[model samples]
Target chain A: MTLLKVEGLRSGYGEVQVLQGLDLTVDAGEIVVVLGANGAGKTTTLRALSGMIPAKGSVQFDGAEVIGRKPEDLVRRGIAHVPQGRGTFPELTVDENLQVGGFTQSAADTAADAERWYEVFPRLAERRDQLAGSMSGGEQQMLAIARALMSRPRLLLLDEPSLGLAPLITRDVFERITEVNQELGTTVLVVEQNANLALKIADRGYVLATGSIVASGTAEELSSDDSVRRAYLGV
Target chain B: MQLFVQRVFDGLQAGAIYAILALAIVIVFRASGMLNIAQGEIAMFTTFIAWNLFDVGLPWWASSVASLVIGFLVGAVLYRLLIVRLGGGHASPLAVVMVTIGLFLMLNDGAAVIWGTTAKPVPRIFGTGRVEIFGAGVAVQVLGLLAVLGVLVVVFGLLFQRTKLGLALRAVTSNQESAALAGIKVTTVLMIGWGLAGAIGSVAGSFTASGNFAVDRNMMQIVLIYAFAAATLGGFDSPLGAVLGGLIIGLVSELVVGYVAIVGPDLRLLPGFALVIIVLLVRPQGMFGSPKVVRA
Candidate 1:
């Protein structure tokens, strides 16, 4: 089932176009990764899709047109975006952060979801009272992902989950993402520069360059591709 | 000792008024991340609205409540019509500050134009009465004002810490983009924040009028300065800090004026401002504000 279908997506900051005519699709219950180098419009693509920025494109989520919708409106349609740099409310406590994530849920559902996410990330559970800013990079990443899930989103958009984590920590984070996808059947569309690690867990992948998808294939095919290995996988 | 007790009661009464006004300033600051230079003028304007309502034979309490509703709508409308057009928090800080200054002049002059420049007598909300505490005679109005301040503090505290609206507010303050992504209506929340501040300003205005026994265009000017010092002393971010800062400023000013022969009643504001300067020099974040933390 095609959950999100985005075509000819164009977006940018004032007078500076970054994402130019991009197209992508994410199926239900699959982990899709968009691999790109720095400034390849990876973040812009996610921003446009999540309605964080103005974009001229057709975004069909669950067969409903979602272009020009605000971020809050999109969230109601079961889309959650965990933005770059974790986007956790630094001054807020971990528990409060989760509560804010459940902004659309009822009080009972919010409480239950908090417990469920806490159980998934015990480190967050231990430091539930601690400020989100005080947590380490890896823990903050886990909390960010958990916070996104608290909305009970059907489609999760993650931007550089491995951005600032140690190699071991990055592996751990990817494992958790895989677990979330398998257990909850949530569709994930993640943008990453860490092609090697991302492809390992991604079911299908696209290589984005200068706001366009240059190459795309199933995870196994892309990992074995010549140009993809030379550019992204570094050999 | 009796004189000291009298001064303490007097200082607390003044402090309660300043605390309420300071809380209004703090709420707007937290919501928009900009100091509203016109908060006092907004209060002054709303107080005039209350006066007009009372002039037309409405009960004093009913007049005050109606003014609060009007103030809230004014605040919300101002945000929707003006602030949002300027890009809200996305605008340059200087631009927002300038706009607020413009509002200050406009509201003050606008009130004078509408209500005339003369001060109008307003009936005390608590009525003319006196109470004796520790051999000091205090007006019943003073104690009532203090009680109102107490209730406002408790109610605001619970609203921020317990309610979902409070959670949404905190989230919006921390990060507007992420708050929207969480399905929280960022613009609506901001409007509510401004409306809350406006409603709070109306309370401060009514209380100030009740304490002074009159309402006028310039009634909130000096009060605003004192409230600023209080907010500065308490740290702009912490509500409790604002209240404590108000009381402390009030007490210090009252005592300095009473005890020091050199600094007479004419220099009552001197001590409050001096204390603010000292607090700023020693602890820039105020007494309770959390210092900006950046993780490496």
Candidate 2:
């Protein structure tokens, strides 16, 4: 069930190192939430794993050395990263963004894949022809997740899905994440500042301070931990 | 009054040609995110190839067709071999612009050596004829211009709307990192975009030869400035806008020459470029460009 394993992952921009000797793993079908403060190397971890940044690390995804590989290669290998701030192709139609999600698939399979996601996210289907930029932020976030899922990835990396959504929308998004995990058996590696909500859905959690993991345990354990409650949950 | 109607038709024909070249410039700009000063030079060189073919006793149609295909090959190869290596490392748009200007000189000098500086005839693709309109005759040349423009519009529209390749090209233009993450090949899209622009430029150049009755070393240079103005009037990325902008510039340029006696025929591009600057001042993103919105 060990789908991804990382050891001593070191990465950064220029000489300012961010992720120094970081280690992490996600077994198959597990939702692992990585909770961290702002500028705590959480985003860098997702970028490095998706090969968006240069890094020195041992990242084995399904038994392949995925480190230093191109971004497209990671996508083709079934690792989808829904970047922070909803990096949807705003100029493209909502449907076209989904089509881009399934870009690597054959013509015969792309339509069926597109149809499944469209059904699952019917708000997207209703605005299929609308330009992505014109959509509401929450809708764009939904499209971003749907677009990522079009690749049918077994491992989905989400960065700050609740950053700007309203409280009601945030709750709906969190609920949808649970549904996606149950229905698709997709393993999710989520980085978020919303520790309370993230821990509610995640099986296990890792608490990162600065650029290192300060604590790690099951979500239930971390949720009850007094230090985690003070620092992250703010309870 | 009849003459005015005739002049309008003539202006539309000329506008259609300018639009093609404008579209080419916009395509190059949107893809590589650089303004290629050498666009006209590369286009001139390709038209010279068409001229050489025609001069060597090949049929006119055959030469023009062969030149377009050659232009596509050359543009694609140029990007793969030269342009791609520039890499975005410390390279500004101005730096790239200067390189293209250098390329312009190289191509111009290169063409002078290979084909000589003399003018050569590039025959019209459609044979000379006339169609009657309201008791007056319109040249087949005008119809030919409309026909070519129509085909280009349809093709480009389809390329933008229905195909995965178009989507990929757009992805690179919109966001390089996200496009790459989505499994879109950004580099390949860049090459294809350049090649398409080049091929269209060659067509415009050949039409230039046919319209002017001679092709020479400096053929594309004048047209290039006018094309820039047209692209500026339209949004930089809107192909349909480029054509529409071209038609307007051509007619207005003609009108400036025809109406105002003092600042006559010779100083045509001066006013045309001035118009573009004015248009840009009014709308930096151009007439059809979608405004960019950013989150706080």
Candidate 3:
């Protein structure tokens, strides 16, 4: 089942068009990654899809045309976006951060889902009372992902989860993303500059450059492609 | 000793009002990240509404309640009609501050235009009476004001700490983008925050008028200054800090004016403002504010 479908997605900051007619799709139970360098509109794509920016596009989620909807309305439709730079509420406690993630859920469901995510990410559980900002980068990233999961979304959009973490921590984060995909069957569309780690967990990959997908294939195909290896894999 | 105790009581009475107004200031700042220069004038405007209601034979308490509701609507409307159009969180800080200053002048003069210039006498909400606390004869109205302030603090604390709306508010304050992604209506929460501040200002205004035994156009100007000093000392972002800062400022100012011969009643505001300057110099984040923590 196609959980998310985007076509002709035109978006940008005021007067500077970054995403020029971009197109993408994510099946209901697959992990898809969008690989890009800096200024490739990876962040812009997610922002436009999540309704954070005004965009001219057709974003079909669960077969419903949902372009121009507010971010809050999109969340109600089971689309959660973990913004770039790990958009955790820094001043709030870990528990409070999770609570905020469950803004659309009922009180009972929020508590239950929070507990479920805490189990999945034990580090977040250990530092439940501590401020999110005070946590290490790796832990903050985990909390950001966990906070997004608290919404119980069918489709999750992650923007550069490895942007600031150490290489080892980045690998660990990717492993967890794989585990989440297999365990919960949640569709993930993550944009990343760390193409090597992103492709490892990504079932399929799209190479985004200059605002649109220039190359896309199975992870194995992209890893073996000559130009992809030269530019992204560094092999 | 008795004189000292009496002075303490008097300081607390004044402090309670400042504390309420400071809380109002903190509430708006937390939600919008902009200091509302018109907060005091909004209080003044609402107090005039309460005064008019009382003049027309409504009970004093009833009039105050009606004005508070009106104040809430006024605050919400201002946010929707004016602040949102100015780009709200996206607007530059200087632009928003200037708008609030404009609001301050407009509200102040608007009240006078509507109510006329003459000061009208208002009966104290808590009837005039005397109570003794450790041999200090304190007005019952003062005690009542203190009680009201106490209740306001407890309720606001609970609202901020326990409720979903409170969590939404904290989330919005921390990051508007993330809050929206969390499915929280950022604009709605911002509007509620402004409304809550406006409603709180009404309480502060009513108390100020009741304490002075009169309502006039200039009623909240001095109170607003003292409240700003309190917020500055308490930290702009901390609500509890605002309350404690207000009481401490009130107490220090009263004590200084009473004891220092040279710094008489005329210099009552000097000590409080001096303390604010000291706090700003020593700890710019104030007593309870978390220092900005940016991870490299």
Candidate 4:
């Protein structure tokens, strides 16, 4: 039932090695969080797995070894990555952005998915004709998530969904992620610096530091861990 | 008044040709984010193909169609074999520009080697006949060129606005990484963009050859400059803007030649280009291009 399994995921930008022998796994229909501070290789891990960056590692997704594949190939294989900074096509209308996300699907299927996502995010439906760049920060974040979901991916990879949003908006984003996990039973592997909110929604968690996993346990255990509390929660 | 109308007609005919060429430039710019310096040379090469096809017993119309197909294939193949290696993004604008310059020289020389340096007269597709409008006589060729331009506009407008492939191309234009994440094949889109530009260039080249009465190795050299001015003036990002820009630049250049004593005949291109410089100085993004915004 392992949807994604990674072992010794070694990757970096150039000579500077960021991810050194990192390992992680996510079972089907589970919400797993990779919690870390800045420079923890959290984003790098997603980048490598999605083939945006080259890496030497064993990344098995859906029982297939997917190392050295292109990002588009990985996307068609149902691994959708909503990168940090909410990379939305600013000039395109909301509908066009969603259409781009559903590029792999058939016309009818893409349309159906559009309707489904719109029902889930009514604000998106209301502004479907508006340019994505003109939308508010929180609305843009929601559109990014919805755009990623348009592919109907088996596994969703979110990188810092709460990066630049207000506290209330961040809460709304987390709640939506939870709804996606529970309602559709889609597996999620989210990486975030907001340890408190991420761990709350995460079924299991892994703590990363300087490109390596330092500690990992169930969400409850990581929340109660003395070191995690001192460092991340400040409790 | 009749003389003025005649001059305007001549300008429009010239403008239509520039618009087609500018459209080619804009298509490639949208997908690749860099100007294809070889664009004019590619069109020149395709013109030779059309002339050769006519020599081999094909009708002029059939030859023109063949040129379009061949031009598209050549452009796509060139991108796969050469441009793809340069890599995209704003990282190395200089590299792309240089590679295209190299391509321009190679194509220019290649055409000469194959077709020889002598200019050959091209049979007018619309035939050499005169038609009068509002007491001003115009060549049938001028009207034909306008008709072709109109069709090109309608076809391209629909292609960009209504198709799934168009959406994918737009996505690739905005952000390659994000487009790939959306399951779009970025390279494939780039190839299509180049191929479409090539097809358009062939059309423009064919019209230019027939309009000017001949095709040669340097047939597109001066026309390319005008097209560049048109693209830059209209906003490189907007296709409609290219057409309008072409028409305006063409009209202005012609009017300057006809009316201005100081500019004279040889320096007519000067005024049009100077205007482009002024427009760019005022709006660096071009007239219709979106201003770059820095996000927080």
Candidate 5:
């Protein structure tokens, strides 16, 4: 089942076009990674899909057109975007951060979701009362993911969740992402510059350059491709 | 010692007024990173409304409640009609600041036009009465204002600290984009924050009018300055800091006027402002402000 389908997606900041024409798809209950270097519009693609920016495209999510919707509107429709730079509410406590993520849910549901995420990320539960900003980079990343999960979205869009963390921490982050997909059966479309680790957990992957998808294949095939290795994996 | 106690009591009474006004300023500041220059004028205008209601035979407490509701509506309406178009967070700080200053003048002049330039007496809800504390005779006006401020603080504190709505507000205040991603209605929260500030200001205005025994066009001009100083001293973002800042400014103003021969009564306002400058110089983020930690 195709959870998301996009074609001819055009978006950019004012006077500078990025993601000129891009196409992508993600099946339900599968992890898909979009790999690209800086300025490759990987972030732009996620931003466009989340309705955080204006875009001219046809985005079919769960068989409904999702383009031209507000970010909040998109969240209600079961799409949650864990934005770049770990968009955690710094001043809010860890528990409060999760609570805000459940802004669209009922009070009882929010509490239950919080409890569920705490079981998945116990480090977060221990530091639940601490401010998000005061936490280390790795913990903040975990909190950001947990916060997004609070919405109980069918599709999760993660943009560079591994940015600015140690190699060990990055590996742990990937393990959690894999767990989120394998256990919950949540569809994921993650954009990453850390291609090697991202592709390790990805079922399918797309290589983005400049603004468009240059190549895409099953994770095993893309990981072995000579061109992809030289360009992104540095193998 | 008697004189000292009297001055301290006078300072606390004055501080109560500044504390509420500062809280009003802090609320708006937290929601929209702009200093609302019109806060004082808005309060003054609402106080005039209370006065008119009293003139029509409404009890003082009833009139105040009516004024607060009007204040809330006026604030929400103004944000939707005017401030929203001004581009809120995306707008230039200077442009936003200028718009508020413009509102300050317009609201002041508008009140004068509607109510006339003459002063009107605002009856105190708790009539003329006195209480003795520590050998100091205190008017019911002072005690009443303190009691009202206390209740307001506890109510607002609980609202902001314990409720889910408060969590949404804090999220919006900390990061607007993230709040939107969290499915919190950013614009609605901002509007409500402004409305609450206006309602709070109504109380401050009514209290000011009653304590001073009159409401006039320029009633809040000096009070606004004191409130601004208080907000700045308290770290414009911290509500607790605002209260402490107000009290500190009040005490400094009263003490300087009472004890400083060189400053004289005419220059008493100088000490409070001087304290602000000194504090800012020493601690740029104000007393209770979170030290900004930027990482690359």
Candidate 6:
């Protein structure tokens, strides 16, 4: 039932260790969110999983070992990552940004895929030709997610999707995450600092401290747990 | 009046050479963010190779074409083996740049060892002809200049506009870390960018050979200064700007040398360098680059 498995993962920039023995997983058709504060290795965990950093661990996606593989190859294996800050290709049009997501797809096939995603996100469709940078933070985030989906990945990695947006925009992005989950059955792995909202939507969740997971449980259990409520969810 | 038009046309033909080298500089800059002071040196090295191949019984066309292929491989392999390692994050910025400057010397001296130092004749690709229009005579070389410029436009336009490779290269330029996250290979694309530009460098070298009508080891470095002026004048990443800037510098240089008899050929370098300073002073973004707004 597990689609991704991370075990004993350790990684870092030059001399600083950010992730040490990080273990986590996302089951098939599940939305698993990793909740943490800044410098808790949340982003580093995502980066390590995506193979952007040097790491010592095992990351198995759909039964294939992916720890040291190139990031582009990870996407080819049906794992799409929408990085933090919504790293949209600013100079390129919304549609062109989406096309970059589908880099591995045949040009002929991608043209067809674009029309389909346009139907799913109408605002993106309307602004298909507009530059990504001209849009609001929320819209750029939407485009980044839509762009990643263009690759038709089985597992979608959403890194800090709600970071730096207004509450309305945050709610909208969260709403869209559930929509994408229901509509496409995308197995989503989200990393967030907004524990309450993330836990509300995530079927299951993990808590990371520094670089290791301290806890894991169903959303309902984590919401009511004393430590979880005090440390995160700010209740 | 006829004399003025003729001077402009000849200036444009020469400007066309600067534009080619300038564009090569822009390509390498976009890929690695290095100014590549050695661009001209690499071109000169390859042009000498073409000349040697020609002397050894390869047809003029074969030798030139062969040089382009060799140039591409050399540019790519050189980057993979030397430049990229030096370009790694830990390397000092000045050290990397000075290494390229060192390459200029090594390639310059190296060429003499392989092909000797004397200048050589390159048989014309278009033969000889002249077309008169707008009160001026345009040699086939001038038309040939237009042809080469047109080819660069078409090729690079398609490269940045339509291909996945172009997308990957641009992505590498903007953010190498995020680009790696997206599964793009930074090293491969960087090498290709160098190789593609290297091949283009040979194209420019061939143009300088045939249009300028002689090729030599010293040619690329001299023209390199003008190409740098053009590249800097247009901003480092602006390909169209480099070409237009080159033509303007070329025309200005010719006008300065011709109309100002007191400043004749000996002082020709003055105007080109002056234009760069003026452009930099007026619009630091160069003539065509959009100002980048860096956010925290």
lDDT of 6 by residue, A23-95 (tens): 8889989999998888888888888877777788799999988889878788889888889995787766788
DockQ of each: 0.81, 0.56, 0.82, 0.69, 0.68, 0.40
- What candidate 5 gets wrong by more than 4 Å, as runs, is A231-235, B293-296
Candidate 1 clashing pairs, residues 3+ apart or interchain: none
Clashing pairs in 6: A71-B183, A72-B183
TM-score preference between candidates 1 and 2, better one: 1
- Runs in model 4 lying further than 4 Å from the true structure: A231-235, B88-91, B293-295
Q: What is the interface RMSD of each candidate, in Å?
A: 1.0, 1.6, 0.8, 1.7, 1.5, 2.5
Error of 3 at B114 (Å): 0.7
A110-193 per-residue lDDT for model 5 (tens digits)? 999999999989999999998888889889999999999999999999999999999999999899989989999999999998
Give candidate 6's fnat, 2 decimals: 0.31
**Candidate number with greatest DockQ:** 3
lDDT of 6 at A125: 92
Off-target runs (Cα >4 Å) in candidate 2 are: A228-235, B88-91, B132-137, B274-284, B293-296
**Residue-level lDDT tens digits of model 5 in B106-138:** 998898789998999877768888787778777
Chain B TM-score, one value per candidate, order as shown: 0.97, 0.94, 0.98, 0.96, 0.96, 0.94
Model 1 ranges with Cα > 4 A deviation: A232-235
Of 1 and 6, which scores higher on DockQ?
1
Docking class of 3: high
Candidate 3 residues B57-129, lDDT tens each?
A: 9988788889889889888899888898999766676888899999999998888789888898998898989
| TM-scores, each model vs. reference | 0.98, 0.93, 0.98, 0.97, 0.96, 0.94
What value does the lDDT take at residue A24 in candidate 1?
89
Report the alpha-carbon TM-score of model 3 versus the true structure.
Answer: 0.98
The parts of candidate 3 lying over 4 Å away from their true place are: A231-235
Evaluation by TM-score, superior candidate among 2 and 6? 6
User: Compared with the true structure, what per-residue lDDT tens digits does model 4 show for residues B8-61?
Assistant: 989998888888999999999988788899999999999898999888898777
Q: Model 1 chain B, poorest ten-residue lDDT window? A: B287-296
